[model samples]
Target: MTAISESGPSGFPPGYFLITSTATGRVLDVGGQAIDDGAELILWPSKEVSLVQSRRSPEADNQVFFVDDSGALCSRSSGHAIDIDHDRLVLRHRKPASFAHPFPKFSYHQELGEINVKFDGDPTRNMYILTSVPLRKPKSFIDDASQFLTTNIRTPFASLFGGVDTNSTPEQMTSAGVDLAEDEVLEEERGEEGEIDDSPDEKREIHMLTIPHQRPWNLAEKAKLRRRFEIIPLRTASKRTTGITV
Candidate 1:
């Protein structure tokens, strides 16, 4: 599976992807598990599949948002927690009560995910049902996600979003997004570069990235990045405060 780049919240990779199964028409995860048999197809949330995925939660209660393969905006359920686990995009009301339904007669596909077969009382009836967008690693209730930067818990989820304020303008949001993207790219390149260094300095550069005092690990993934040729932080002046600052 492709790895998500380490960076800001946006760098967090989706735990599941939506794809179609060959035997059944249902979409599958990267592992080929059905998103759910007969999962109503929709667009992925990136605007374009190639664009970065959105990390923020649903903004509207009346709407269900999901990352359709086409990366367009669409609704899933009125308000159910849709999740992408392994290969299946499971959708159902996120409640302890809903799981009381009976099991299937065939070999249990617990790993195949909760099947939503609709039997209208006939021997093999079709139960027509629907659900909402996908959520990853669903718990009883979602909470703040901490990256656990250290064993001690000094860092918080808010740290990922430090510096910026809620009142910032659209221009600021755009600038921040650009910076995060660049940092992600640079880190990826550095990882690639670290593998093929041949010269003395190249070897030294790789070695120094792990040095303790240099604080190689101090930089946030979204901050500006530079070639850590020798345990350096990747940074640059923001145009807003570049030459105009005191």
Candidate 2:
């Protein structure tokens, strides 16, 4: 989908959001393809993308990040985000190649055929040729499509694009160790093995702060901690082909 801001920049040529914010909701010009600046972008006959929702909360912007020439919208200098409804729409202005890995929806058609194996001599071909190697039955079209829609076979930005620093050993430890972890009061009084740990909620806020304006939606990262519920982002590598090419 695409939308033009009646109030945002009117001279944007064509490219991805090196910087932008969307708390206000996305707007677009469609470069004048649409009748108005606020015209909504929809699921072109192709269901590969869609605009299921829209809103005009307030005129807000998020931080945007960049590295060399990787054309992707960013909420921070490191990752990405869709923190505002408006920001979602503005992303449409991006060239298809920008978010090529992340389609709003998926669609594909396939046909399976049985092989008529031949002995290479007789009039009738009854069975398929077999190999010593074991083979799995092909999944149905629906199964294949579902896999396309839901499978995330990529490492996260925290590990990619220089997000996480595995080499940076902690100069200070805070969170408690296994011995006193069972007793909350004791752990609180005596700091943990790491630096004095902050509350999870507080840490979440800190994580959000790390986002660039354009990458606001990427604020879902969970700080490295005991097994916790948080958004784990999966980023695809910039490559020509994806998994399971038919």
Candidate 3:
């Protein structure tokens, strides 16, 4: 499912809050914000990245954490509580040994509308707070389409860059996370499906215009893309691949 956002994808439900690092200036983002079990939680830049590329930022369902009745901080995306393994943060299903492990507790600063989390039995270590970050709002189809074209493997190229769906009504486009201008929407709707040539040459031209020629393939960029696209792996990458590929 492609995520859409108006403000940011990191928005949580009313009772939940974003956990940000005081030292890093990054919010706690589930690895790719991918809604999967055992997804690693990491500190990512406060700004919107993959899933919330648009200003109509939908909620970052993966980042939201809940304070369950058991006093354990649980993830909305994975339904697992936050845990520490060998001093590294991770998410895992509760087990018998989980009882001995420290769980997170939440505290609110009502005057500032800020929330913070503290690890069990201690108020100092591994604490995170809530903060706001600004995001770009002037959207472009190229910016988003480029990302979609590069990342979406399920949809074929011809279907993706078919030069807009003339059959779709204004409401349909909006529901599908498209934020085209009123005039553009109407014009596209009225356009004859055959009027725009979808020949091989024309499709290539349209593809070049909507999508970028090249994308960043650095480790950090790929990691972010994986999370945003929800690319699940059957098994973890081998240590050799991890060391050499990156």
Error of 2 at 201 (Å): 10
List, residue by residue over 1-246, the lDDT tens digit for candidate 3. 221121111222233445543323445666665655455566554444332223314456565555566666666667787765433356767667746565655454433334444555553333343322122233478966764654343233325776435455444445455687532332233233212222322001000001112532232222122122111111123224545731
In order, candidate lDDTs are: 0.26, 0.22, 0.41
TM, every model: 0.17, 0.15, 0.32
Query: Per-residue CA lDDT of candidate 1, range 65-95, in tens?
Result: 3333322222333423343332223443333
Across residues 87-139, which tens digit of lDDT does each residue of candidate 2 receive? 12222223367653431210111111111112224443322211011112445
lDDT of 1: 0.26
RMSD of 1: 24.7
Ordered list by TM-score, greatest first: 3, 1, 2
Model 2, residue 42: what's the lDDT? 20
Ranked by lDDT, top first: 3, 1, 2
Model 2: residues >4 Å from true position, as ranges?
A: 1-53, 60-69, 75-246
Query: Using lDDT as the measure, which candidate wins?
Result: 3
**Model 1: lowest-lDDT 10 consecutive positions:** 202-211
